[model samples]
Target: MVQSLARAGCEVTLVLKAPVRTGRLVDPLRGLPGVTVHSPHAAGRIPDHAVMVPRWAAGVLAELDEADPFDLVVVRGRQIAAKLAAGPLAGRLWTYLTDVPQHPAEFTGAAFGELRRIADASRMLLCQTEELRCFMESAVPATAGKSVLFPPVVALPEGLEPRAEGAPAGRALKLVYTGKFAPRWNTYEMTRLPARLTVDAEVHMIGDKVHVDPGDPGYAPRMQAALESAPGVVWHGGHPRAEAMRLTAACDVGLSWRHPSLDSSLELSTKLLECGLLNVPVVLNRTPMHERLFGADYPLFVATEDDVADALDRVAKDPELYALAAARCRAAAEDYTLDASSARLAGYLADAFPAADEKVLAAGGGRKLRVGIAGHDLKFFTRLLDYLNSRPDMEVRVDHWSALRVHDPAKGEELLDWADVILCEWCGPNALWYAERKRPGQRLLVRLHRFELYADWPRKLAIDNVDKVICVSPHYRDLTLAKTGWPSDKVVVIPNWVDDKQLDRPKLEGAEHHLGFIGLAPSRKRFDLALDVLEELRRDDPRFTLFVKSKLPWDYWWIWQKPEERAHFEEAFRRVRRSPLLSGGVVFDDYGRDVAAWLRRIGFVLSTSDDESFHLAPAEGMAAGAVPALLNWPGADTIYDTRWIHRSTTEMAQSIADTVRLGRWDADRRDGRAQVRAAYGLDEVCAQLVDALAGHAPADLGPAMMR
Candidate 1:
């Protein structure tokens, strides 16, 4: 990676945790142009190696940065990145994660917390695979746009020719394995492959044994015995990386078959990439990632130890299959070559750090536009606020309201006085206050969600003083005009944005049978309808389950205080407990900010609301690669495709069942994801919001409204 950066014209500074006494350690990078290595001395006692190493490294980096400011600082490990993130140079860090949690269940505790801190501090997150990038974005919502793909770069032997021959004609078929002999790697099991093959074969192993599983203490001894005594096996342990690659190049096939438990990991195997670069056919598991690299029809894919032995026999017998596998490996490996990786790095750097342009400043009259956002809850506008604050052409401040209709009068008046444009987040009292007090020439914009349109706040808002009223949907925009008698030109539609990059993640195993519904409050959200669908689906397929992520009725005082709402929820709970099928089928998870992670278990997101201006849950579900089954609420067709919209619970359940039974669930999910990304992507919608906040009125509005 350092070589790739240096090759891309970057002045790379390589930092080592400990000084290297032997020249062999740094021999590969020697004489590389524009690359420098630094190993700083630790002066004091090192209490804990994990904590002290990072601390000493951070101090050395701080000193180096002070002496010569770096355009960017790259760190590989999560621990080191977290330590450096606490210092002053956090903004310049480009964190490259070599190790990360593989499953959603693993994303917790202190290590995961450090990952989040590192993500929040780093300028860019370099991921080793597309799946890892998606996991990082979903696990930590902050790393959405900054998280990028930087797959493993294959380093081939110098002047090595790509193999064009089939399996050796007269001799044994040589096989190679080039990583650790951890229990999960199935190295011990691989040692027995030579005995099982129909043709004579040689198995070459080239790495030290790593004991990782404490539960099975006998694994290490068994592995040692197999490596030493197994027939036709030659264990060449712990060679230098270059030498290992050369040894692997001479082999006819690579062994990468592993335990099935690791099949769901979000990391790509570097060993597989090396084999591909050498044009050697590898016997590997049939994982989604491996299938993508080597097509599903690749002849060497194996699921079990017995399958591995069978695949080897078939490869030895068929020369045509051997050649095809070799060609496919070489073709797939071309994208991960050193030159290709360097070009990708250079492109990312160019896009991340563009040359400063004065056009935006000039357009804004030689200064940034001072925009003030006033609201009690900015949950819907959080991404927009972050976007506006990140821009060089705009300055933003916020006057946070204490309640829906309450705020500090002094702070509100001060913001009104200072801001060139005041954006009222909701058409609540803040809008009424800003509309009446905003000075002439200062633009005032009010955004009305569904709740406010039904409230008295919209009627009380001074529409004459407001420059524009932003509605999340065209339906709400028209309703606002009709209800408040607001001018048609003043009301404009700007749909809610979905962070597609953050939400788009791979579905977990058996997600097709799982359905999700978020927010079942206010009685109008129609929790009863969701139960009807779940009940109907379970009647046909008992594997179907409903995962409800919501705040319980008692959690919201407004809903619990009403007798009708209390009765509605109590009856629903009774029905769930009384039905034998529904008792274990329905799960109610606590509502929280980790919606993306929760969505992985959900294949279908249910929007069974009676009425909604613009329900965001279905869009978010689509972004997460989950098909949405939405009720045909009023104006729902305007926001979503009709295929997702159903008229009744029975129809919705039937659609979901048909999708699963016909194996069309994944295809529908892919289509829905693409559609939602095109319509409600964060960057696109935020850009539109910024234009409106900057006093750039819609084309339909007259020029008189524009600043």
Candidate 2:
């Protein structure tokens, strides 16, 4: 409303109850004309821009009336609304209520009722969506007779270029998601889709970090590494609205996802408008907001990730269909414009505060599901939520860290009551205890990538409550099961899925003498063994190539293991660097999945790890048709199948020799690719997860006994 009024030449006064970073606000709006920033700090000065630090309910109540009053005041959410009602401004205010506050019974307070009452008293209301407008009406039935307006588009700078569409013939399908994500957005959901969607579409995300505290010890670097190490997605950190829109304009699609909460159901996302205005076709799952906006626009609703390409296929084959959808998006957007919306709101305010908008009561009547995921490092989780929201069927309600002191089974039960399934990656020992004690109905599915087990944290994580534990590799699963004493029935081995496009990517020229392995953490990855493999190859053939890239510590080879083994491995790594076997101080390209080009040049890829799990390195190499020779073990064997496993160094060497002699792995190199397709392709694996969770209950409900 403010943006619209400002654009209309009004001297807009912006008030912030909380004093946030100047970099966050002032930097972006520094030079805008007719914009006055007001907060508690400048309450008495009446400066154009004022904000109060540590704003209290009492402080705002006392200050709002004393300051320069305007023709209109926009109260952003419930808290602001309450202040308007309880203070001297009550009879003279307009409520810009964006969301209906529906609190749990235990936490419900008089303030919530007061906020509703204040909104009811307002003559007019402004909401983000018609759904929101309806929700507000129901919450305060008396407001039904007053003025109401849908949320307005956040105005973009004039003359801004629209985001471009991908070229029909030459461009790969581009899928972009832009939004501020909390757990409710279901970012983890996206992780399931990348490996499933087979189109040449690139997935892009713009989101704020939700779970990790930058101030917390050891969090910053770990979070940074995870973002750096993610296999097949792009992350552009939070940007200004203008820059974000500019980025959005270059994409082909947009997404808005929410958990099944009354707040979510009543909410309409700003990105929806931005994407539509930018001519980016949106793909949404079934939701109240989606139904309200695009119910008749059948072409815009996609039910699955697989359905996405079909939607794009229509756009690809028929320009007119794309144009038609683009036009409807524009029409819906105009209905949400600030000028049109704020005008209706102005009239509502003129009539005096009436009653709460009646429609809100009806919008809050669903059995909203509240799912929770536990973890401290949220960068990965946020990405996961973004991905989940891409799915049309699932909605995540609560995504919060389990507080250590809050050993509340009721909290877990509350989530279980609302959740269909619990998707957990990180949890301490108590999480399981909490899950186990919850009322018998929820289903828990825990994901254990290699690091989770190798780090020795499971003993501390209460594992008994988890109904199905997902492991990325058979080797990791075996090790974890042996360590945790968890039954085999509780374990479900699901390898990390890779997109199919990665399988068919063009191979780079084979290395003259290069041998490569990718992954960090030298100890578990056995970079020392990588050195040994190189040395052994070099002894027989001087030109033998050796390339090792890992995130493991440099001195892990020199320390932190049995003395005899450490010395042996350290010598091996040192000798390889000094000897003819190594091709320079091995290029450690930190992390990224562009290893296909590197693997193509290498004659062979080798894994000499003492421990095993489904090694992504060899599976990826095999996907590129690069023959892999791994330490035959549980994880490696599971992925390669018995037919492809090599038992020893002699067998490993002979396997490579045979590949070279035969010129390919039989007449079925295509079959090699097919083997990976059947076993580890992204789409095939995600389908497996969807199937696993479909007939199940939420994990917190109880153990397998409940199932």
**Candidate that scores best on TM-score:** 1
- lDDT for predicted candidate 1 compared with the true structure: 0.83
| Tens-place lDDT digits, model 2, residues 93-137 | 566665456333322557456655775555456655554544444
- Tell me the lDDT of candidate 2: 0.56
Candidate 1 residue pairs in backbone clash:
none
How many pairs in model 1 have backbone atoms within 3 A of each other, for residues 3 or more apart or on separate chains, i.e. clashes? 0
- lDDT of every predicted structure (CA atoms): 0.83, 0.56
Error of 1 at 351 (Å): 8.6
Q: Which candidate should be chosen as best, given lDDT against the real structure? A: 1
**Model 1: how far is 485 from its true place, Å?**
1.9
Q: Model 2: C-alpha RMSD to truth? A: 22.4
